[model samples]
Target: MTVRELLTEMKDTSEVIIDLAYASLMYNSSTMAEKVRGLEDDMDDLKFATRYKVLLSSRTREDARQLSGILEVASAADRISDAASDIVSLLRFPPEKRPFITEMLSEADEKIRMIKISSDSSMVGNTIGRLQIEASTGCKIIAIKNRRGWTYDPEDEMKLRANDVIIVRGTDDGADLLVEYAAGRKEWEFEEIVPDDVIEDEAEEDLQNEEELSEEIRGEGDEE
Candidate 1:
């Protein structure tokens, strides 16, 4: 099959997985078990298609390797989903039996805290460095969402403008502390700043090198 056809099939399979997840959330254990089985089947089909594409493509070995790695990740996700479904099924006994299960799920969800912040303050600088220094409580900046772009790396150095959303990952207490600080109720100290352009240039250079390597492999294949 062509690349476009493979990608379309993958999208459809992803939709089925999402639907199964939603059904599990709303239905009982018996019903969700069946849906989870169906999702596992769809995931297997996607894994087969991904592997087929990588095996058939001949332009770049690096591209094939990357696609193979993606298939591996998909397989792992499918396994984790199936295991979770099994655990959920065991909690269908009685009201008293479900307390432990409920507690476990709640604890798992509470560990990963997500906090949203706005960069429209006057004391904050325009880049991530200032935010990192200002929010100095061992909290890490995981993602940045803006009107112009969305980044998921620590290397993001774009100027934070008004209405920009910054997603920070930390503990529950740390996230709460950040929210309090952002609301002007708490005091914070500042530190040195770094230019955004320097980080952007490094990222650009890395991308350029990867592209050049791919092009070189394509040219060698053409010469043969």
Candidate 2:
């Protein structure tokens, strides 16, 4: 199947899985497992399509591996969604118990802040550890989208290469700091005037690093 076809199938199957999870949460236990089984079947079909696309395409092995990894993540997400719904179902206790449950859910949801980072930015070149340090100084890089559209976890150790968009979770001030950092401004210098010499030196260092990294990669390729 074509990439579009595979993607469409994946989307459809994913929706089915979501629907099953919702149904399980809203309905009785007698029928919940059956619906979950059907969802599992749909997930299997998605995996099959993903495998077929990877195996039949002329893409490089690395590309295929990446695609496989994405499918695996999707599968895992589906499972987690199902589990979350199951937990939600358990919260269907009497009215007295629901207030506490509602408060817990609200607290859980409120703790997370979602902010997207533009793909084209200096923050893309930084490592996760670097991003985390920046976050601790008040900007959290919670997730990232690599070129393949797969989201990277905060601690994945995958360097934030250019063209990767990131999602940060933090307070409003923290998110603002992240945006400023992504735009190449330090938190402490957000409002301060940048000296020309500092800018020039940073630019020179960046260019030198780019050339060195390129040469290193090229040398590795040659050795291989």
Per-candidate TM-scores read 0.36, 0.33
Q: Which pairs of residues collide in candidate 2?
A: 124-160, 135-139
Question: Quick one: best TM-score, which candidate?
Answer: 1
RMSD values for the candidates in order, in angstroms, are 11.6, 13.9
Worst 10 residues of 2 by lDDT: 21-30
- Backbone clash numbers for all candidates listed: 0, 2
Off by over 4 Å in 2: 1-83, 86-120, 133-139, 187-224
CA lDDT, every prediction? 0.55, 0.54
Taking the tens digit of each residue's C-alpha lDDT, what string does model 2 give over 113-208?
343444546556557664454535454443456766644234646677755665443456665666665655653232344799998999999999
Model 1, C-alpha of 37: deviation from truth (Å): 2.0
Clashes of 1: 0
